[model samples]
Target chain A: MFIEFKDVSFKYPNNDKNVIDHLSFTLEKGSMLAILGHNGSGKSTIAKLIMGLLKATSGSIYICDTLLDEKSIDDLRQKMSIIFQNPDNQFVGVTVKDDIAFGLENHQIPRQEMLEKISKYATLVDMMAFLDANPENLSGGQKQRVAIAGALAMETELIIFDEATSMLDPKGTKEINAMIKKLKNEHNKTIITITHNLEEALFADRVMVINDGKIVLDGSPQEVLKEQTILEASGLKLIDGIAIIKEIEKTSLLSKENKEKICEALWELTFKM
Target chain B: MGINFQNVDFKYAKKASHKQLDNVSLNIDEKDEFIAIVGHTGSGKSTLVQHMNALLFANSGNITIFDTKVVRNKKIKLKPIRKHVGLVFQFPEYQVFETTVLDDIMFGPKNFGKTTDLAKELAIKASQLVGLDEELLTRSPFTLSGGQMRKVAIAGALAIDPDILILDEPTVGLDPKGKIELMELLLAMQNKTHKSIIIISHDMNIVAKYTKRIMVMHSGKLVFDGSKEALFNNEALLKEYNLDLPTAAYLAKELKAMHLIDYDSLPLTKEELTHIILGDSCNE
Candidate 1:
């Protein structure tokens, strides 16, 4: 496994209860995985654990077959890049271009080559027009684009989005979602997304539903979201495709089997629409 | 008028600025209605909402909240105007500065000149509105769960007893249950106080299901304003704004196109869609 969570359990420092408990999962290389759950479900906790921001209390996590430890921590981060929820919190540079170059600078890439990478990423996220803009001047979504450009420049093998879309508007939300899909499809990089917008997960190859510090459901959106009762119990509802399924199921015009096929076809229809 | 924006344009204080609000005009009725202002990032949605309470003044044009225009008006006091309009910034937990939950929530009321006794009463009531257990009143706000802390901050806004409440991305970063509970509490508050509520959000599905009046912004322009149905019907407008129609609204349109459902009616929720699909004759 490129990344594996082996029955890992974790608690924030000094906290008695584990935020992530008995969590075991695997991410194959180049597969975009969506992690879904409500607040306090330990989804973000799982992200922090993978990013080496928190230590696990039990079990083990392996990234690229390497055990996590202080000696390997820096190297681990070098290969894994994470985009946090708050765009402002992650910005380390003054201007968009400088910000994109921050990571490359840390990696000790020369200025000349780093400039090329920064420009490339800026264009990739459609922030080329704002390359010289101050980070604080940009809106949340614009700032996030810069953050994503910075992360993309790192070209990390595994990318995790910790509710990165929460602050963006609908168009901004779609823009970033498309970027994630592009990364997975064209770049051959593994992706992990923690989001409440289950609609965004339609294109994802796999999704894991976590709750109460444990993964409650593990499957495709078809396997999980098709069951509205299960989703609602977890404070979620069917998103795009599954929503169509539920709608068609109500009509009684289509059999349960047809409903599934139509739901499966939502992606194709959405693209054409 | 509950809120009004006229030819309002604002650029954030820094340079290399994307115009946050550009030549936008809007009018919100005095009817105690639930309104949602939704747009993608850099769409001027926040700029418009902030203008409601004078947190960010318009660079040009006028802003009127309630009956009085927000200028150097001698007739209406700005302090009282601010007290009448309470604004809750996003991730409100970060604004918690008091030692305890009760004290934090009471800060606004006390600052607005309510007695400590009255402030405490209001705090307790506000906490209940947001579904916080009273035992947490004495607990440190810093130590509470993220969801609980958000409720505490929202309760802070509630303490002022505002006539109008504007929340900027109030539901962001919350789990769905927390988001729904908060929304329900706000709805309850709206019922009890008859206060006007404005929610600034980017999520179309949320806006579709919750608000009575919908406003769409893009490129700092107020692109569309009307009912949720109208907003969804204007696919060209929604597309021009770079926003996706709410999946329900979008799917309903598709089903209508396919002759699978009613073309004129847009279903806002899954339950409604189910009713339409199953021919249950029950309105969800």
Candidate 2:
């Protein structure tokens, strides 16, 4: 497993109840996982735990077969990168090129190699044209692209997107979604996306839902999303067409076989559309 | 009366090549108006809404807010216009700076010259309107959950009792249920107060489900402004503006293409689409 959480549990210092309660999961290399949950469901807490920003109250976390402890924390983090929700808060440099280079410089890549890596990753995210442009002047989507470039330039084995597209417009969201797909397929990077958007989750290889800091559903998107009751209970919903199908399921108008056929047809149709 | 804009144009900088709002004209009623303004990022949706409360004066033409008239480069008492139109910015949670939720909610009413006691009263009422718990009002706003913080911020906007309310991408970060609840709350508030509501959203589903009027901006131009049906049905306008169909509308289009379902107008909600799909079965 590329990443594993073994009976992982976390609790805030001031809170009595555990925020993450006996959670366990595994992610294979080069596979994409989408973590869906409502506000304060401890979705972000999972990310922070993985990034070693917060210590677990109990249990253990393993990355690349190495136990995440005080000694291994820095080493494990070097193999991963995180993109936060707010694009404005993430920029570390004045220009796009400088922003991407900041990470490379931290890893102490030689000056010549850093320049080449910056151009390569920037081109991969389609932000090559805006290398010299000021980060403040870029659109939300463009800033996120630069953030992606920065993450990719680090050459990390894993990338975590923590509500990365929540602040963007539809076009920006689409752009970032496409980039995530490309990263998994072409770049062979293990990716974990934390989002409330079910539409974005549809593309993930696996989907895990959280509710009140507990894993409510864990399976492929098809399997997990079909449990609309569970999703709704967790402050989530199936994407539009599937949601409509779920509503149709309650009505006795259609025969069982016909309902199944319509479900398949509508699901495929909605995706293609 | 309400708000009217006639050939309004605005530029962020005097030397800027393009106007943020170019030759935009529109009318909004003070009562019973639910309008959604949508466009791509940096397409002037934000700029257009900011003009409503006199946050940004026009570079040309004029804006009439009730009895007040605002012209280019003309200074007026913005307090009255602001009092009449409450603007809730994007990520309204960031705007909460007071120690307690109640203080934050009361800030708006206080700024508008309400007495301390009256502001507290209005704040409590507004908090209740947003479905906020009374216990949370006394807690630090920072300690509340994201949804609760958002409600607190909205309560701040509502405390002033504005005739018109404007929200910029209010549902951006909320979960599915939160999004629906917030929209329902806004709808209920509008119905109860008979005040106009304006939202700038990137979510087509929310716009299709909530707002009656749709305004599309592209390249700083009001390319299309009409009913949701007209805007969603116009393929060319949608393509030109880089707008997407709401999920129900898109599903309807796909179903029509497959020759499985046919309709005169696109369904904008799941309920509407389900009705069309199930047909007589639904009625039965």
Candidate 3:
């Protein structure tokens, strides 16, 4: 397992409620997993725990089968990177090139290797042209591209995107999704995408629905997204394609097999339906 | 009874070469209007709506809201214009500061010089309009859920009793259900009050299903202004503006390819697409 969490339960110091309650899951290496939940459902807490920004009040978390603790935190953090919802908040350097190189500078990488990594990652995210441009002047999509370049330049084994596309327009979202798919398919990057958007979850290898800090549903998106009742209870709705299938399932004309055909047909459509 | 902008040009700085609103001309009726302004980021959608309430004055040309002239040099009190044009920014929840939901909703009305009793009444009415209950009104706004906090902020806007309501990406961060519920609430409010609504959004689906008129902005220029149906049918224009076709529109195109539906014009709503696909065999 690349990452594992066992019997995790956490509560804020002043609060009686456990924000995350008795959660257990393991993620395989090189697989993409999406975490879906309503606001205040402990999704962000899980991300924080993985980033070692918040210590697990109980239970254990292991990276590469090594237990996560204060002693291993610095080393573990170097193995993972996180991109937040807002790129403006994550950007640290004045220029895109400097921002991408900021992490390597922390690692004290030699100047020659740092320059090569910066060029490689910037080219990967299609931000090479704007390497010298001010990060503030870029569009939301472009800024996200710069952030992705920075994250990728870190060369971490695991990357967590916490609602990274929430602030973007649809075009911007599509651009980011394309990059994520590339990263997963071509580069074998392990990913955890935390979002409320069901459509985003459709691209994942596995999907987990979190409610009240527990995993209520976990499976392939095809299986988990069909559970309309659970999705509704968790304050989520199906994507447009799945939603249309659900509505079609209500009719007498289409059989179970035909409904499945609609799902496949809709999924195969070049454009989003 | 409407807002009119003519040859309006605005720039953040006088020395800035590019104009934010380049000769923008548009008319928005005060009654029975549901409009959506859509474009990519930095396309001047936000700048356009900010002008509706005199929040930003054009550097050149003219803007008339209802009957008052809006100009950069004008010293007239903008409170009256702002009173009739309530502008809700993205994430209106950040504006909620009152201890209780009721007090938060009443703040706008009270600031507008309504008596405490009248403000309370308006607060109750606005909360009810947004589907917020009296019980929640007494609780701390901070304690409410994200959806509820958003409602409280919207209620604050409604408490001002604006004739025209403008919201910037109102459903940006909401979940799917939350997005639909908020949009439906706005539709219900529009139905009950007949108030004009202007929404700046990138969700083509919401724009297609809810708004009657569509305004396309591109690079700080108004490119197209028309009905949603017309906008969806214009593939070339949609591509030029970097806008995606709504799902309903895509479905229509696919159905046409399959020889399932033969309508000359594309459909912009799910129901219309369903009718075409199911061949009117399913009951409405």
Candidate 4:
């Protein structure tokens, strides 16, 4: 496993609540995993814990078989970069170009090399036009793209998106999704996305549902979404394709008609009927 | 007769920037109804709603809200329009300026010249409406959790007893339960007070389920204004405007693909969608 958590429990220094409690999971190299849950489900907390933003109260995390401690932080952090839920909170530079350079600066690449990486990623996320644009002046979607470009420019082995698409419109979201997919395929980067929009999870290799600070469900997207009760209680939705199958199971139609209606509905719903 | 905008035009003249909103006209019915104005970010969605209250008066043309004319040429007393139409911004954290929760909720009512006692009374009612506990009322506004703080800010808006309450992305960053609770509270408010509720959100699922109508804004124009069913029925159109059907509607459409559903009308909720898929067996 590239990243593994062994019974990790995290509680804020003085807070009573264990934001993430005794949860353990793993992400293999070059694998895409998605965490699905409703608000306050500790989804973002888990991401923060992995990134070493918050210290765990108990247990430990291992990166590539190395126990996570203060010493390995520099190396572990290099392998990981996180995009927060709010684009505005994470922005640090005045211009889009400068923001992307923040990461290259950390890696200590020379000015020319840094500019090369920044220019490359800016075009990748379709932000070349906004490269000179002010970060605060860009629209929500544009801000998110610039943020993504900054992370990608760092060449982090693992990319964590904490509802990164939530701030974007549909077109912007689809663009980011396509970019994430391409990175996982071409660059072989491990992608972990924490999102409430369940539909986006359809493209994930696997979906894991976290509730009440625990990982209650983890499986292929199809398997997990098939369980209606668990999804409803967690406030997540099944992917569009699978959601229709479950809906058809509830009603008792005539034997021959049953097969027919299911087909008709799928066609109509999928843009054919 | 509640609000009217005739040939309203506004231009933000940056040193080199061009116009934001071209000449546009719209009329809003005051009686109990919900309105959602959606557009890509910077498409003038926020700019237009800011006009509902006296936040930004039109540079040109006639404007009216709650029988009060408001434009560059109209009466400048914005106090009444703001009181009647509360515009809840996207991020409550930016809007919350008070020290304590109680003080925050009292800000709007206090600004409206209500006595301290009346402001407190309104605060309590608004707090209950948003599911905020009385215990948290004394705590610092910044100390509360994200979900709780969001409710407190909304409670502050509700304290003024706005006949038409407008919220922009009330559920952003919230968990599913929090989103559901907020939606239910808004629905409850609309039910009891018959107050007009307008919500601007990117969540198609929420829009499909709760909203009776939608107003799609694009490039500073009102592109589509109609029922949710009509919008979902035209998935291609929604995509053209950079939108998609909700998960439920997406499912309904998929089931239709398999010849499971006959009606083309898009149902908002999963319950309604289940019946549509079951066809005659919907009740069962």
Best by lDDT: 2
lDDT of 2 by residue, A147-239 (tens): 999999989999999999988888888899999999988889999999987887888999999998899999998888779889988988668
Off by over 4 Å in 2: A255-258, B72-75, B280-284
lDDT of 1 by residue, B213-271 (tens): 88887788887788887877676876676666776666666666765556347777655
TM-score of chain A of each: 0.89, 0.96, 0.94, 0.90
Task: List fnat per candidate, in order.
Answer: 0.51, 0.77, 0.40, 0.58
Residue A106 of model 3: what lDDT?
A: 90
DockQ of 2: 0.70
- The stretch of ten residues in a row with the least summed lDDT in candidate 3 chain B is B275-284
Which DockQ-derived CAPRI band holds candidate 4? acceptable
Clashes of each: 6, 0, 0, 33
Best by DockQ: 2
What's the lDDT for residue A18 in model 2?
94
lDDT of 4 by residue, A1-273 (tens): 998999999888888988788988888999999998887788888888888887889999998888888898878898888887678898889889999999888778999989899989998888998888899997777788888899999888899998988767666677778888887788888999999867667678988998888988899876776677898788775544446566565545635566555645553443321
| Candidate 3 lDDT tens digits, B141-216 | 9988878889999999999999999999999888777889999999999999999999999998889889999999
lDDT tens digits, residue span B218-261, model 4: 77777787877777777687878877667677665555565555
Task: Say which candidate scores most in TM-score.
Answer: 2
